[model samples]
Structures are given as C-alpha cells and as structure tokens.
Target: MGELRLMKGNEALAEAAIRAGVDAYFGYPITPQSEVIEYLMAEKPEERTGMVVLQAESELAAINMVYGAAGAGKKVMTSSSSPGVSLKQEGLSYIAGAELPCVYANVVRGGPGLGTIQPSQADYFQSVKGGGHGDYKQIVLAPASVQEMADFVKLGFELAFQYRIAVLILSDGVIGQMMEKVELFEQMPRMSDDEIAEKYPWAVTGKKKGAERTIITSLDLDSRKMEEHNHHLQRKYAEIIDKEVRYELIQCDDAEYIIVAYGSSARIAQKTIQLAREKGIKVGLLRLITLFPFPNVQIQELCKRGIKGWLAVEMSAGQMVEDVMLAVNGNGKVAHYGRYGGIVHTPEEVLQALEEKIIGE
Candidate 1:
C-alpha cells in the first residue's frame, strides 16, 4: 500500500499511469479529461519514471499514436471525451483488428454531438457495442470513484496485455472532477525490451535472427481469412465474458427491488437505495464494474431470485436498460430513469422514479 491522499479522479488517473509504468501516453485535450494530460505534463513523468507524454493535435492522431506504440509492444494509453472518442473510432477499429494491447479512458461528457461538459453515461452503447467498425470488442471498465479511476489504469493495462486487446475505462464528468481519498499503489518499472519480445513475440519490432518478420495489420485480402480472424475475435470475447464479469451486489439479500447502474449512476443509486430503505422499501443495487463483459449471468441469477422489479438508472436516455431487460428476460418489470444533456438525476429523483415507474406499478 502507498500513501493516501485526497485527489480528483483525473489526477488520480494520471498519477496511476506513472505508477503503472506506462511507456507512453499520447492524447489530445478534451473537457472533463484535459486534467489527465495536464497533470502528466506538469509531473514530467519522463524525468521521474522515463515515461513519454505527448499532446496530439487531435483525438484521431492520439489514437493512431497509441496504435503505433502498442504495435511495437510498448504500453501506451490515451484519453478523451465523447466526441473525441467518436473521432478515435477508426483508430480503435484498427487497433482491435491488429490485436494490439493498449489502454484508453473516456471521461465522458453528455453527447450526441458537442453535448455538454457535464457528466453522462450516454456512451454506454458506444463503449460496449463496438463503437468502431468491426466485429470486435474492447474490454470496458467503468470506474465509479476516484480510487477506481486510478486503479483501473493498471488493471486495464494488465487485461489489455493479458488478452492482447484494448481496454477502455469508461468514466463520467462527476467521477472525473470529484475529489476523494485514494490510496496509491507502489510504482512499477516499465517492461524491458527482452520482456516485451518474450511476451509479445508477434509485435512489430525488428526481426530476430532467422525469425519471420511480424506484421501488425487488420487488412486481409482474402474473405475466408478475414472470416477466420473474426471467429478468433469471437472466441476471445467469449473467454473474456466467462472470466472477467465484475459487479458489486449491495444489500441484495431479501430485497424486493434491484437498481442497476454503472459509473456515476451507481454512486447515485447507492444513495437511492439508502433512501428507499428508510421508507421500509426493500431495495438493492447492482453496480456494474466491467461494462463490456457485463455481469449478465449474475443479473440473471438475481432475477431468478424473484425480485419484484428493476430500475436501470443512467445519465442517458435509458441506454443500459436494454441490457437489463435482456438479462431479466421478462422475468419481472424493468424500467429506466435518466436525465440527458448533462443533467444528472439526483437521489430524490431516482427514488421518485423507482416508486412511480417500478414500485408503484
């Protein structure tokens, strides 16, 4: 364990990047997340830990830089908000197709276009459902707190390299700007060249003596080969689904209702649960930690336990509710409550929605 300090989520993420031994960070400035790169620059991680940080002109260039560094078997990362993440979709698709490992964080703001600088979970669909053009998936981790904002950087990198796939940390403006006490982890040294070669033999580094040169690309001219590649990706996604479903079940025992939420919504739902309980309403919360490998099985099992109803709370217009409905499979009624365009639902509002939309009915 390292020292505990009060930190903002964005700053925690930057410090954790340094401790996680990231080789490079290439990112463009975006609202609610610009603090990430700003902190990195001010810290001068290059002097402290030999980490390289560069500010790219656009999200497109930043993600492409990440692709290049990751293909060469280096630990790299980037961060942006919703629109910027939208711009990086092409590069993300390329990274996924090439099967390179890297980390990305989207400190999301409200948006379909330049929505708002305020918090939102509207990007849930985009993050989990392959925002890029491909039959591929990236591991998506939703951090509900400043601690998790820091912790997920290392965890995301671990999973990315472990599976040779990209990992995304999905956060919102509330979590990004909120201050909280967080305990940091001990610093880790960056991987050596030999270690990288041993771990990622297929990386696009220079060829070894008599070894075939490695090619990092998503292009396959042959249709059959591309089909086979897609199948391979499917297998990887299945493996991740089986092994990495993470969620938090709070006050679930004997509860009659469950509230499903992730990221900042989870925090609000927690308060809603408390308020509901005070009124003698048996309410519980299911906090999703990994959005990509969604805890579907767990949700299904909870649904089987005969809960009366469910409320899927989010900062968007009921996006994640679709997943909850699918998981419930009509076992019970499921409703959605949300505020869009950067308007976050308060605990009172969530509780009211619960009573009117779910409990009352």
Candidate 2:
C-alpha cells in the first residue's frame, strides 16, 4: 500500500509528480498553487528522485521550459493559477501544435484579469475548449478532492505521453489549498535515456548517423501540409473523446433529475444531492472527470432514461451549462446557477437553485 498522509491538494500533486517519475518541473509562483513548487523545492525531489524543479521568472518562461524539455522526450510539468496560466497560453498552443507530451495544472482562481485569490471555475471554457489559439483541446482532468489532485497527476502524464499531447489538471483554489487524506503512490524510476529514445522516436535526441533526424515544428508555411496537420490533430482529439471520456454518477441510477458539475463544484453538489434526496426530490449528480472528453454520451444516456431536468452548478456565469443543454437536446429542463469571478457557492445555495430553477420552474 502507498503511504497515506493528510496533505493539501497542491502539495499532494507535487508529491505525485516526484512519484510519477516526472523528469522536470518548471513553474512560476502563483497564488493557490504556489505550494506545488514550494513543496517540490522543500522536499528536494532533485536529491530524492533526480527531478529538476525550477521556478522560472514568468509563466511564459516556465511553459517554454516545459516545451523545451518535453521536446527532448523528458517527462515534464508546470503549475500556475488562472492569470499566470493565461500568460502561458501561447506556449501551450505551440506545444499542442507540435504534439509534444507534457502536463500542466491550473489551480484556478478568478479571472478576466487578476480577479481574486479565491476559487472559481470560470476557466472551464478556456481549458476544455482550448485556451490558446488554434483548434486544439487539452485532455482536462478535473479533480474533485485532494485524492484526485494526487491521482490525476499520474493519469495526466500517462495520457499525455500516450497520446503525444499536453494534458491539463484543471483544479481550483479550494482543492489546491484544502487539506485531506491522500494516498501517495510509490516512487517510480525516471525513464532512462535509452528508454525515452526508444519510446519517443519523434523526440529531439542527438541525430544518429543514418538515423532519421527528428524535426519538431508547429509552423508549416505550406498550406496543404498545415491542413493535413490540422486534420491529424482533429483525428487525435476524436480518438481521445471516444476512448478517454471519464465521469461519475451518484444516485443517478433511478433519479428523475440530474445536477451536472465538476471539480469543487461537484463536491458541493454531492452535498446538495443528499439534501435533495432527504426532501424526497430524487435528485442525482453527474460529475465530470474529463471535461474535454465531456461525458456527452453519458448525458445523452441519462436524457434517454427520462431524466426530467438538469441543473448545472459551477463557479462560472453559465459556461458548462451550455454543454449540458446541448447534451440534453430539449429532452429536459436545463438551468444554470453560479457565483463567478472567484465566489464559491455552497451546497445550500446549489439546492435552492435546483429547487427554483429546475423543480419549481
């Protein structure tokens, strides 16, 4: 069994990174998630596991470090909060365009600008839909608890290298700062140079005599070639949506109404489910795990099962609710309730919104 400890989500994630065999971490300090690098530095993973942890001057510099290391076939990651993440979008897009394998975490706070240090899910659109330019989507893992904050790190890196893509652990301030029991995974040995060269033939290792020299670039001036590359990315995304969709259903087997949420919002909605059920409201919850490979199929299945209404709870104005509506496709009543710009809603508020928006309506 792995060691169990009560740890904050960000620290748990850091521990998981070292254990998951990440070769490098490059990140700038940002609130709610600054602990990730702090823990990494304090624990001295460099001494323990030979993991390189560096705090870059800015988010742009940090992400470029990840890109450079990942291009050389090293397992790498970074973490930042919302505004810092926004600064890294260009680098993220470049990484995605190059089809490099890496992972990053956005311990989300508020935003449009520097909104608040408190939690918010307003980054949902940017994350699931592709925060940077171009038609690309990161495999987003929304962790609902401290346990998942640790677990998704392993899963994120796995998915990243598996698909040759960047993966996102889309967390929030609450999950990042909140302390809870977490099971730390066993330490994994970092892949040897031979192993990386063998596994990632596309990686930029030293060109061997008569060996194919790897060329990594997102820019293709040739129109048709760029189109082909775009098609390849689209196909990759389609495969991910098909094969990697993940979610959770709570009290949904026989429920007539569904409350859709993810991450910290889903945690609160769990409590809302209990309250609704106690009041004889037969409410259930659909918690999204992979927000990009959104459980469209599952939502459709629930709709077919005659789920009467859908209430979407989030820390956004109404971003994820649109997806819920599209998934429901006029089969049920759909409404959204949220406190955006860094305000976190409570279980009671979620229940009341469900009553008025879904039930009372």
Candidate 3:
C-alpha cells in the first residue's frame, strides 16, 4: 500500500504524475492550477530519474513541448485552468491529428474571457467533442475528489498509450484548492527499449544510419486517403465506447428519479439523493466518470427498467442534458437543473428543484 497524506488537488495531480513515471512536464502557470507546477518544481523528480521539466513561455509553447516530447516516445503532460487551456487548443488539435500520447489536466474555472477564478464545468462540450478542430476526440476523465484527481493522472496515461491518443483529466477549481487524503504508489519503472519498440513501432524517434526516416504528419493531399483516415478514427471511437465507458450508480437499481451528474456536481447529487430519500422521494444518483464516450447505453438500459425521469445537474447551463435526452431516447422525461457562470448550486437547492419538478409535479 502507498503512504497516505493530506493533500490539495493540484499537489495530488503533480505527485501522481511523478508516481506514474512521467518523463517530463511542460506547462505555463495559471490561477488555481499553478500549484501543480509549483509542486513539481519544488519536488524535482526530474533530477532523480533524468526526467525533464520546463516552464514554457506560453500555453501555446507548453502544448507544443508536450507534442515534441510525446513524439519522442516519452510520457509527458501539462496542466492549466480553462483560459490557458483554451490557448493550448491549436497545439492540442495538432497533437490529436498526429495521434500522439500525452495527458492534459484542466483545472477548470469560469470562462469565455477570463471570466472569473472560480470553478465551473462549462467546458463539457469543448472537452468531449473536438475541443480544437477537425474530427478528433480525447479520452476525458472527470474527477470528483482529490484522490480521483491523482488517480486519473495514472489512468489517463494508460488510456493515452493504449489508444495512441491524448487523455484529459477534467477537474475544477474547488477540487484543485480543497484539501483531502491521498495515497500514491511508488513510481513505475521506465519502459525498456524492447517494450517501447513492441508498443510503438510507428514512433518518430530518429532515422538510423541506413534506415528510412518515418515522418509524422496530419496532412493528406489526397481526399480519398483523408476520408479513409477519418473513417478509421470513427471506428476507433466506436471501439472506445465499448471498452472505456465508465460510471457509478447509487441506489439507482430501484429508483424513480435519477440524477445524472459528473465531477463536483456528482458530489452535490450524492447529498441531494440522501435528502430526497429522507423525504421519501426514491431518488438515485448516476455519476459519470468517463464523460467523452458517454455512458449512453447504460442510461438507455436504466430507462428501459422503468426509470421514470432524470435530472441533469451540472455547473453549466445545459450541456450534458442533451446526452441524457438522447440516452432516454424518448422513453422517459429528462430535465436540467444547474448554476451557470461561477455560482454553484447547494445540495438543498438541488433537492428543492427535484421536489418542484420530479417528485411533486
């Protein structure tokens, strides 16, 4: 077992990266997430393992650095809040196009223009859909607590390497700032050359003295070839939906009303479920852990089991509700209850919304 300690979310993320055997970290500091960089800088695991950590000039530069390190067949990562994350979109798109492996932790804050330094989940669409451009998707993990934040760093890298795609840890400001208990395993050993070669024969390390150089590019001059490439990606996504979809159900097997939520919103839903139960509402909570390859099939199965309705509680206006609607597939009612911008809904308030619409009405 790993040693347990009280830690903040940002610190836990940094520690987890080290424990995950990340070779380098390239990122610029931003509010609510700067602690991740600060922790890494102070801890300096690079010195022990010959890893590299560089503070880039900008978010754009940071993501490009990640792309370069990832191209070299090295595990790498970066972290930032929403605004800085937005700035990294161009590089992110390029990384996606190249199908490189890397991890990005988005400690999300309110946005649209450096709106506020508070927590928000408004980036749901940006993360699950192609946040940058083109037909691409990242393996997005939404962590609800400090422990999950740390654990996802390891989980993200595993998924990244397995799928040859980038994985994102979608966290929020509150989780980044709040303190909680965490236990991290010792850093895993570095990949041997034979293991690396077996895993990534397509990696662009360098050309041998007589061998041909392998070039990595997203461009396809021929329309037919590009169409084929897009089709391949769609097929990969379909595979991911079958293999990677993850969620947690609480008291849902016998409930009438279900709360569909993720990240911190799920925590609120947990408390709201308890309150509704005390009032004899027969409410349940469905917490999504994997947001991208959404748990649509599961939701549909639940609806078929006579789940009467669903309340999508998010920190955004109405993002995930669309997915819930599609999942219910016209069989059950699905409504939205949320607090947009920087404001968060309390558990009592969420319970009230359920009473007003789901329970009483």
lDDT values, one for every candidate = 0.94, 0.94, 0.89
Q: Candidate 2 — which residues are off by over 4 angstroms?
A: none
Please give, for residues 1-361, the per-residue lDDT of candidate 2 as tens digits.
8899999999999999999999999999989899999999999998998999999999999999999999999999999999999999999999999999999999999887999999999998999888899999889999999999999999999999999999999999999999999999899899999998888899998899997789988999998999999999999999999999999999999899999999999999999999989999999999999999898888999898999999999999999999898889899999999998889998999999999999997
Model 3 lowest lDDT segment of ten? 190-199
Candidate 1 residue spans exceeding 4 A from truth = none
Instruction: Please estimate how well model 2 matches the true structure, expressed as its whole-model Cα lDDT.
Output: 0.94
Worst 10 residues of 2 by lDDT: 208-217
Clashes, model 1? 0
lDDT of 1: 0.94
| Clash counts for the predictions, in order | 0, 0, 0
TM-score of each: 0.99, 0.99, 0.97
For model 3, how many clashes?
0
**Per-residue accuracy of model 3 over 220-326 as CA lDDT, tens digit each:** 99999999988988888889999999999999977998999999999989999989899888989999999988999999889888988899999988898998998
